[model samples]
Target: MVKRVGIRDVAELAGVSISTVSNALNRPGRVSDELVERVRAASDRLGYVPLQAAQQLRVGRSGLLGMTVINIANPFFADMVAGAEDAATAAGLRILVGNASDDIAKELDHLELFERVQVEGALVSPFGPVDAWQERLRKRGVPVVLVDAVDDAGVMPSVSLDDVAGGRLAAEHLIRTGRKRLAFVGAREEVRQVRERLEGARAAVAAHPGVALEPIWTSTATTQRGLAFGDELADRRPEDRPDGIVTSNDHLAMGLLHGLIARGIRVPEDIAVVGYDDIEFAAIAEVPLTSVRQPAREMGRAAAEILIARINGTETPDLTNVVYQPELVIRASTSTAR
Candidate 1:
């Protein structure tokens, strides 16, 4: 095997001292432009890749940011990751992504791992209570920014969509469309997002005395679980079924739509459906889905900015919390017209 080239090789090739080569690679601002260019050219010519860990150890802080999300498989979270990468790159920082998969223990594990790795900061879209973990990370000198979830206690900075308003919008749309028998699908009590959305739907239903709301809980907020719930609903007698349904996310909505179609139930005319997150699949399903749009990518970018500010000691505590509004996107699933 070829011998691995080191920084010493670059220094020798560039005719500079080892310290000058180090400065050029680790902290370019400290080195003169001429020396920096020469070091870079020598490094390129020799194909030398500096050890990031050693450089970070010398600098006392890594330029790496940690990001923990509930689920990366979801298109919504995937978009969030993309936005975060874009923003972190702009800030001259790199991001390490971890998926907690909606498990609180897994979420805590990811946080502990990031802390041990000595990341400068973290952006977390939590699965459960975050203040305790936030405090722990802060005690270790790692700043944290919450993503797509709020700190109701006002202790942690967060960037999230107003899920409650999104829920209300979904339910109110069904009500306006003349569907009175309403049902909410997915287990909202477990996740803050779904819970807040359920609260919003409750508020809307409370406003209309005639609209009775029924809630069905699912084991997970995945498409498979949605399909199961939809199958169960399909088994019910026609008169006993809900006239309108709102799901926790678009995955569930699409699965439920497929389940309904398999059972020969016509969409909109039979049962109107509304889903959250407005994922790409929502628009292309057999029946276009009506959904509540959360600005996931913008939320991720905003969270990264906030976390970077805190890491740089430039963030104002009072302005740490950022909440974006949700919008309703109507489609054939909820409307008869194309």
Candidate 2:
């Protein structure tokens, strides 16, 4: 095998000292323009690939950001990752992603990996409590920004949707369309975002005197579970069944909607449905679903930008939270006689 060329080879070719070569390649601002150009030209000619890990260790910087998401299967999270990648690329940095799949143990393991890698910062979209892990990262000088979540103490910056507003919007729309008995189907009460949505729906129901709200708990927000719930609801008497349903996610909502339509239930006429995260499939499902739109990509980009700002030491005290309001997308799923 050919001998691997090192920075020393590039320095020799450029007629510069090893320290000058290092500064020109890693921190260009420390060297002159002519030296940087000459060093880069020599590096290109020699095919010298610097060991980034060793260089980062020497300089106390990695130029890498870490990201953790609850579930990669969700389209919303995927879109968020794309948005974050946009910002990371623009800043001349790279991101390392860890998919926790909604498990706290996996999430912890990812955090530990981030620590070991000496990431400059992290974009954490947690499924459960992780303040302790976040604190540990902070102690290690890794600035963290929350994505799709907020620190109750307002210490860490965050970019997220107003989930309570999203839930309220769904419930109010159903009430406007004359849906009285309504049910909310969601999973994982331990998740903060899901709980906030339920709180919003409950608030909306309480405001309407004649309306009644029922809460349904499930294992996961999957299409299969939604279908099962739909069958169970359709089997009840007309008077006993909910007139409308609000779901935690599009997957469950779409499945539940499919289940209802398959069971000879007239959607909207029988029971209207609304879902969250107006994902792409929500618009083209068997029955177009009315959903609350969360600007997932935009939220992710915003979170990454904030994290970059903090890492660069340019963040302001009040730039800690950025919350976007949810918009309702009305579709045939909730429209009458469509």
Candidate 3:
């Protein structure tokens, strides 16, 4: 077996002191350019990869920012991760991603892992209240930033969409297009985003007399749950059925659309459909979906900036809570005609 080369070997080959090699690798500005080049050349020749763990211990903090999301497989989270990666790269830092899968225990486990790793900071979309964990991290001098989740504690910075505005937009559009009976298909109202969205929908529904708003709550946000809800709605008497449907996210909307199609119910003709997140697949659905576009990438970038600022000893502005407005993307799914 080939043995791994060490920095000592590179230092010997480059005729430099171990301290000089360390300075060249970690703090290049502390060493001359000529020496840095020589050390780098020797390192390359010896195939020496710096020990990140040792370097992190020596520096007291790793240049790694941990990010925890509910669902890594969701396109919305994937887009956010891409944006975070770009931002972290530009800042000369790295990101460590973790998936909580919407489980409180899993979320806590990831937080514990980040604490053990001594990550510079963390960005999290909590599965539930993380107030206690936030306090523990703060006591340990670890900064935390919330992403796609509201920070009611006002102790942590956060980046999220104006879900209430998004809900109002969808409902208003449906009402303007003469849709009176509307249904909202989504996860439980306990979730902050879902609750805020429902609030906006209710506000819109209140403005127009005779307009009815129905809530179709589900325990899960999976496609199967959406399909089941759709199947049930399709069986409703025509007069009792909703004329328009607003889903919490694009994934649920896609499943509902498929179920509707399978039941021979034409989109926009019999039931107009609108969804949130405006994921890539939303536009590619059989009948291109109308959706509310969340600034997922922007949220990711902002979260990184906040965490980086905190890590760099800069006075992170007071728990900044950025709530970007959602835009309406009209497509065939919500058109007036089939």
Candidate 4:
């Protein structure tokens, strides 16, 4: 095996002190540009890689940020992570991504790992209630910023969408199309987004006389779960079935549409479907689905910026909750039949 290159090798090659090479790598501005270039060139030639642990210990900061998501397979989170990466890179910081898969214990483990690694801050889209960890993190002097999650304790900063308004928009659109019976298809109601969206739908339904909104709760957020729900709804009597369905996400909406079509149901002719989180698939679906578009990329950028500000001590430590409004995107799925 080839011997690993060290700072001493780079210093010898550049004819400079080891401390000078270290300063060039960590605090470049403190050294002359010519010397910095010389040290960098020598380091590149020697294939020297600085030990991140030692550097972090010396500076008491890692220049690394941790981000946690429920699922990375979802396109919505992919875009958000891309945006976060761009923002983090522009700020000269690196991001460490962790997927919790909706497991609270795993999420806590990731948080502890980030703490042990000495990450400057964290950006997280929590899977469930995190009140128990708030004090633990605060006691350790770790700054956590919630992404796409609400700040209930008023301690951590957060960025999220107005899910209730998004729900109301979908319900109101269906009602305007002369649909009275409505159904909401979503995963567990314990999720804040799902719960808030249902609340908004309820508010809209209450405003219209004779309008009824049915809640179709699913344990899973997968496309198969949506297909099953749609098939069950299809088996109901036409008069008893809902004319409009609002899905929690675009993936579910796409699956429900497929199931409805397979059951010989015509969209808008018999039932109309609308979804939230207007992900990439929404536009390319067999029938373009009307959806509420969350500013996912913007949310990610905002979360990164907030975390950076917190790390740099440029912003107040008080909690901040910024909720971006969701926009309604109209498509063929919700169009009224002529």
**What TM-score do all the candidates reach, one by one?**
0.88, 0.86, 0.86, 0.86
Q: What are the clash counts of all predictions, listed in order?
A: 0, 0, 0, 0
Pitting candidate 1 against candidate 4, the one with the higher TM-score is 1
Cα deviation at 112, candidate 2, in Å, is: 0.7
The per-model lDDT (C-alpha) reads: 0.89, 0.92, 0.87, 0.88
In candidate 2, what are the lDDT values of residues 1-338, reduced to their tens digit?
A: 99999988999999999999999998999999999999999999999999987887777788899999989888989999999999999998899999988788999999999999988899999987967587788788889999999889877889989999999999999999999999999998888899899889999999999999999999988889999988998898989989999999998999999999989998888999999999999999999999999999999999999999998889876677999999999999999655
Query: For residues 163-193, could you state the per-residue lDDT of candidate 3 as single tens digits?
Result: 8999999999999889999999888566788
Could you tell me how far off, in angstroms, the CA of residue 88 lies in candidate 3 after the best superposition?
A: 0.9
Off by over 4 Å in 4: 1-48, 316-319
lDDT of 1 by residue, 237-321 (tens): 9999999999999988998998898888899899999999998888898999999998888889989988888878899866599
What global local distance difference test value does model 1 have? 0.89
Instruction: Evaluate model 3: give its TM-score.
Output: 0.86
Q: After superposition, how far is residue 264 of candidate 2 from its true place, in Å?
A: 1.4
User: lDDT of candidate 3 vs native?
Assistant: 0.87
